[model samples]
Target chain A: MKQIVSPGCTTGPFFPVDFSDGSEDLSQRNGLAAKGQHIILTGHVLELGGKPARNMVVEIWQADASGIFRHPLDPRQQDCDPGFWCWGRARTDADGVYRFTTIIPGAYEDRAPHINVAILGIGLTRPLVTNIFFDARADVVFECVPAELRSRLLAKPEGDGVYRFDVILRGENETPFFVE
Target chain B: MMDDSTMKIDYAPYDDATQTLRQIDKYTPSATRVPSAPLIERPLTLSERTGPTELVSKWNVGKLDLCRLAPDSPRALGQLIHVTGRVTDEDGAPVSSVVMEIWQANASGKYIHELDDHRAPLDPNFTGQGRLVTDEDGRYEVFTVKPGAYPVLYSGWWWRPPHIHFSILGTSWMNRFITQIFFPGEVLNEKDLLLNGVPSRDVRDRLIFKPTDTVMGDLSYIGYQRDFVLRGHRQTPELP
Candidate 1:
């Protein structure tokens, strides 16, 4: 028994400020109050020639405008208010560029009006789940979600509430790893 | 005298790091309820994996996968993990028990799902997924739930760091490894797009973070060690 050469995987840390448990009364539902989605959300972590990725660890997860899901079969909702932590975590200080301050989320019907982004590249093995739209509606949620996730959606929407979503991680149409 | 080669690990201990971030807690991965509601009587699926493959045969475990511990931190309830690991193929040897399955993101990445909304709060110890079978040299273990840290929005903006997600199979090996482990200096591994998709920097520095060691009396939770080989034929079941 001796044929090992399969070791090389890292990239896991999209949200671990110790697991931001969003609590403004569970992210305030119905009455509204879930809007602080901060946005330093820079970009650089290059490598495929771009060059940057200093330390690595940029995780982020969303869902609070009533769609409900801080987690655990529907955590009931309404808990992240005062000072707001709609969910944020960062790790890229050498130049790879990573920042956070989250909140801007409020829309969920599940037909085709998406907002579910995941990156977990912290140590690297696999995880880049992509999905961030709102550039005045990216072709109506990419012609109604589900064409293999409508081409990973992201039509350059940077109007203050911020939106860029750049993750080429590894060549030719790369960035799409979602099973959870 | 439980010796199949003598292996055991359960964790807990780390005073600072924001008190280990309030003792890790976040699990919300629901495709939509049934995890437990007065429901306990099923476990008997043995083995199966068909279609669309991200490999989710009802999240596997069978025999009703237990679930009762929740009294309020009885050392963080039952969760479960016996993982031994050591299944050599392609060229390596060992290859005994085999049959493994794992899933993560519980310490609080939210995953006890029914279609996730991300509220966070479910560590009745953590189940995430487990079903062991590997010990002779190709060790294997399972106990479940420690995966917290969930958030990501990239290009547009947001972040997440702190993770765990694994799945394995054997007998010519089926292959599936979405690996993750970081906590040593955890500043959020440079925008974590799967650690920038590992282009290599000494293997992303071996996926950062590792100081875990517990086993004195056993309060449970002695994890954060990593290993995954699978590269003999590359099954191509899909979901890398």
Candidate 2:
């Protein structure tokens, strides 16, 4: 690899919770409701070897119902919902489970509706970067996901607005991470 | 089989896998957690190209100086030092407004975290956490003390030299870089398992920051510099 930076180091179970400064709810801003279908997103983060990844931090960023990102990088005209912050953070509990209260992200240019997730954990040398689409078969860029790995990246819907997704970091039913 | 967004953006196949960490076999945590499975290579769609910029500015985040809790607070116990660095992309262009968060052990080689039960004395005034934001030139500086060395638990006679851990958030998700800043001339740099895990010797040296000629703060604090190069946008002349 031409990249020359030092690879990375494990947090060694000493990560400071305040460093992340993350949130669990992105659907409301300053007590105002964000546009679109407000839903509950929850999941577990386990090692492919089946170890519960406790105290690890997860960050999620997505577009609002207008398919507009709150970020300045979205080149489109600024039109995101005023109440949606478009990003959140959650830490896995003792059972490796994390929960987030947000809304269904809308599809954007050439890409399907999805949530971008970046994770940092006790044992992970590098933060695992991945995305979770809303379905088994998503449109556009998701096609790049191999058919067999599609199940790993799709969010499984429960009875109501709650969605369950599991992130397996190594060895077994691991979700496919992305690199440009 | 690809999207016809030819008008919007061009995508590239997976950039070859990132540098692999050569396990030292002693650090049991990474040995089991490092993914052995292949990761999916994909294009830098909007999701990867954009992220929450200036996260620190929005929140009431403050604490760039670790030696002192606040400007008026008492200085933590240790030798105060100022760390300076520039963040750039592979193209050597500056990536401004990036948030760089750092965590380290106190001067006694002890972390304030509950997991760390080392007998080293923890400075009551020091939490050992600091954060900074890069300027338009991608330059950042933070005030901290030289952390002490501590032994690796369960590892026979393994000691980690003074090192600071860094998590840098760049323009996008893929640009996120996690690394450690080592002090130059520290004998421990040569013995650190995680530092040596990096395959290349040259890259290992890059992790060590060197002293700067000019002074940054009052004569009390010393300045050291190291520049970082994060992955940049893939070059595609064929794209619109």
Identify the leading candidate in terms of TM-score: 2
TM-score for each model: 0.25, 0.88
Model 1 misplaced regions, further than 4 Å: A1-10, A14-94, A97-180, B1-84, B95-104, B107-119, B122-136, B146-240
Q: Model 2 misses residue B186 by how many Å?
A: 2.1
DockQ for each of the predicted structures, in order? 0.06, 0.44
RMSD of each: 22.8, 4.2
Estimate, for each residue in B64-131, the C-alpha lDDT of model 1 and write its tens digit.
12122433434333333323335454445454544454445666576564434567776664555445
Candidate that scores best on DockQ: 2
Native-to-model Cα distance after best TM-score fit, residue B140 in candidate 2, in Å:
0.6
Residue-wise C-alpha lDDT for candidate 2, range A1-180, written one tens digit per residue = 234333555665666777655478888786689999988899888875788888888888888887887666676627778788777888888899999999988887687889999887666666777888897555655787788778888888896898998988776787787652
Best by lDDT: 2
